[model samples]
Target: MFLAATTAGDRVRANPGGQAFCPSCMADLIPKCGEIKVWHWAHRTDDCDPWSEPESQWHIDWKTRFGLQNCEVVMGPHRADVVARDGLVIELQHSHISPEEIAERQRFYRRMIWVVDAGEFREHVDLRLASIRTDPYRQQPTTYRSFRWRWPRPTHARFTSPLFWDFGDGTMLNVRKIHPETPCGGWGYLWTKPQFVRRFAVHVDELGDALEDGATA
Candidate 1:
């Protein structure tokens, strides 16, 4: 994780010898500000959130976009990747996940979505223009495209939450739905980075309100 809680309950980024605790379990955290990997905090023992994978630069970049307070949010016994002001949990997935684990997270968060790092599979995935129609999400004329993976990941078939695929580009593929056909394919809406963030995250001006609500709650 990039941030840990101070004794005063304030969220802070990792610093050398920074004494902090895990927001989810109150466990002592070791500040890992190495020159090699991404600077982050690690629990002295084990991670409180079993769903958490090792943070990569990809994860850090996305979390940075959402801001520290909004990322790594504690909800009950688990720490969410990103929780919007409207109570939407956004899970950033980069590593391989089991179908059963995906279902478990959906059940835990209840109201959640996924922003998957699909760069690794981008080369194997094919996109075709399906139609040129008015996109209800963007409220504009958009080019709808259908995506098909040469060899689809089994986990993709079990996804129940809304999913957006990020391919290291400045745009996102908002998957409308997965196709049931033999060669797995789906039609989706395309969104720019700014558009998706604006539509999902709380406005910068309202971040104070979000923080206050979290503090008070």
Candidate 2:
């Protein structure tokens, strides 16, 4: 509960592969909330291997590679352990931070990336679990599938869900959006919280064409 207790709204990251590995229970997972966020890591069964810890070595590697320094290991706000680097709060699974911490850290860089370790999944866990989408599986999942980001003053960063279709390429021609106001047709445009303007539709044919035609510098 440290995740919920400590870092309430401290920016949540999604369990990539659309699944999580519960430390308390060992099995494949279905996200608890209406959607998935690492802080909401849980298992349908009672016994699951949690993403809890000082944090996994994979997460450590990600931090080091990304240049995190003087990190502290404390539970979200009221539990276990969390790592905070350069004013950025790093929560593994449910490592939550306090509202005060969030407000204070807002002035600095508010960036964090949730991680999934390839070595920790079940034997039955498919490497393509994320791509499987609606397929059936028996093992609990462990992989960083999706990412959620937040910024204090609103950043120019954004992402869109991939598009699908029956065109010659079998890929959806989506659309390119620099911001939420950019006008996306049938496909949806996604924007991170706070700014709520930076949005995009992944793999848009327009973007692809722009890149191919060298319209994008």
Candidate 3:
């Protein structure tokens, strides 16, 4: 967790030896201001949220983008990475997670959004995108649903917010507009299908605007 609550119920970033408490568990938190990594708060004992993942520089960078508005927010019994004032819970995921876990989180945070780092899957995504570009379905309006990728499952159709895929580059791909399709002969299998559009590709800095637009829509 990056932000902890002071005794006065104010949110604060931990400094070495500073007194802080977890907003969810109310356990003592220690400030880790080491020279090696970004300054953050950690539980003195065990963390209440077992699902919490280790943070990376990429995760830190994304959280910093929210400034003070993005804090470790307590949702239900767990703490979310960032909960904006607009009631959007932003989860910055950099590692591979099980589909069950993803589903669980989505169910738990009803209005949550995901920002997945595709740095490791760049080559795969590139190939998929290239293939999508030349796909015959790309030219037809009705067949647009056939353009898809593998990672962002089309089965997660219930997710209201767009899943943002960040390749650690300047651009991001919005996977929310994609629709899932099952082949007629296949036995109830969801396939990756996306609607290819130049506008769906956006700059990293424009994420805030995108979220606002998505919220309104």
lDDT values, one for every candidate:
0.81, 0.27, 0.58
Give a tens-digit lDDT track for model 1, residues 5-59.
9888799988998899898888889999989888899987778888888888998
For residues 97-127, write the lDDT of model 2, one tens digit per residue. Answer: 3444444433332343222221222232221
Clashing pairs in 3: 147-194
Better of 1 and 2 by lDDT: 1
Cα lDDT, model 2, residue 87:
36
Error of 1 at 91 (Å): 0.4
Candidate number with greatest lDDT: 1
TM-score of model 1 vs. true structure: 0.89
Model 1 steric clash pairs: none
Kindly list the per-residue Cα lDDT of model 3 for residues 91-126, writing each as its tens digit. Answer: 878777676778888889888777778677655432
Score every model by TM-score.
0.89, 0.21, 0.65
